[model samples]
Target: MNTARLAADLVEELDEGGLRGSFLVRDLHTGREIGIDPDVLFPVASLIKVPLAAATAERIRLGELDGSAQLTVQPGRISTPGPTGLTRFRYPARIAVDDLLYLSMSISDGVAADALFGLTPPAEVNRLLRAWELHGITARHLLGALSDTPAERLPAEEGHLAHSLAISSGTSGRGHRIQQLDVARANTGSARAFVDLLQALWTTSKIDAVVQSRIRELMGTNLLRQRLAPDFTSDATTWFSKTGTLLNLRHEAGVVEHADGQAFAIAALTESRISAVHQPEAEVLMARVARVLRDHLRHG
Candidate 1:
């Protein structure tokens, strides 16, 4: 099939599947690539943790912050709702900065991420990205801000309405009535931006070596594996990835390293027209589209 035709088909497939996404797959060694609007930006939900972990680890490496330092999170302090990690804990817990890093990346724990955010705010994270010459990703608010949205305050029966609001209340400029969904106010990134970051992380360039490696290990153990991991994981390949989700947005970014020394950096950031949460089919379709790009790049 011709490349342009394939992309056209993929775009139609995505539209029929109720999603529109920015996806890219690149061979890290050759720099060859395949993508579908990979430069389009989307509000990154928990994907902000990848950079947070990196910056926090870099600070630790620079002796500016102690990873072993403990922060006690009272039960009431877990203000955000999450399926795993410290958010689910019901008692006061003294957790180390290093462990908080693990929980934030591995389990998508908002409480742990905000605690780390308390140490290194969004501005400092952006500063580190600028210092490292990383561009296109903007970190603006704490993870708790995501939890305080209209979606969270809605009743169970009104969940789909929240999704509808998310889908419709956006401007042409990527601005939204919801602050967390607005690119200017939210943690946002493009597939190209994330793939660039992944390339740097994998190559250990533009970032401290120890911190880069630690972020990889954290992503390798990431617990939110239902998105891109299924398509990339195998005995001959290792998938290190992170997932991000808001009301109608879903995304994943990572590198898949094959045993034969071939590695590909992948970024799939998507938004859905469907007005419901728990869209398992959307997750599957997201992976399939990304896998097509990966296979196309890997074989070329």
Candidate 2:
């Protein structure tokens, strides 16, 4: 394969596929890069699972959380796509934490994700993100609502007093404005930072070595079999990936390894102005980009 030509073609194909966003493709071996914008943060969508998985695994390693504990599913866990998660259950459902994680990452299960958010409260998530040294990564407001807050009986004037105090403290109005807004954007991460995380996963550093292996296994087991995997599967090549899609946005970030153990971590994210249900346009772009990146690394 003329890998250089393919890489150039990938850029043209992205434009034709109704894509409108920034992206980055790097050669993990030689530290080469190919893309227009790698640092600009695009809505991460389900790609947020990467960090969530890391945070959860770290928690498990620290003995702060139990992975095998059973968690009861509630009705409110259901959420809309793009701004929310993928729902797999309806009615009162109960599942183990281990199963919940399997469903969340492997199946991209939204219900399972909501259950996880509840189990690992937002405060804990914030703590975990900071511990990981990841900046600009945190749960959105809706996800934050799942936190534990006790309701106390108070006079009606207490609400007014609280608002007055918040305004006095200069913290209340800022949060209120941010909350009432419904900007349907996804999560954010840079190409370089993302690859650094992937390298950490590959080397089993910055998190529990055992849990990182499990994370890799979950990525390999991802059920979204229609996109990048179809074009680039081989017995000699292994692709550990987490794919994300919502409306006109399609993203796939993973490490591709050849038979000789040479590997590269790549992330290709695209956003199209016009929305497509099956997202055939966006998928085409992703496949092209994946193929180009793989071919480039395989030969170089």
TM-score of each predicted structure versus truth: 0.96, 0.75
Please, what is the whole-model Cα lDDT of each candidate in the order they appear? 0.89, 0.60
Error of 2 at 218 (Å): 1.0
Q: Which stretches of candidate 2 lie over 4 Å from their true place?
A: 1-9, 76-86, 135-138, 141-186
Q: Judge candidate 2 at residue 209 and give its lDDT.
A: 85
Q: What are the per-model numbers of colliding residue pairs?
A: 0, 3
Per residue, candidate 2 scores C-alpha lDDT tens digits across 8-54 of 66667766765654555566667666554566555555666777777
Q: Identify the leading candidate in terms of lDDT.
A: 1
| Prediction 2 TM-score vs. true | 0.75
Candidate 1: residue pairs that collide: none
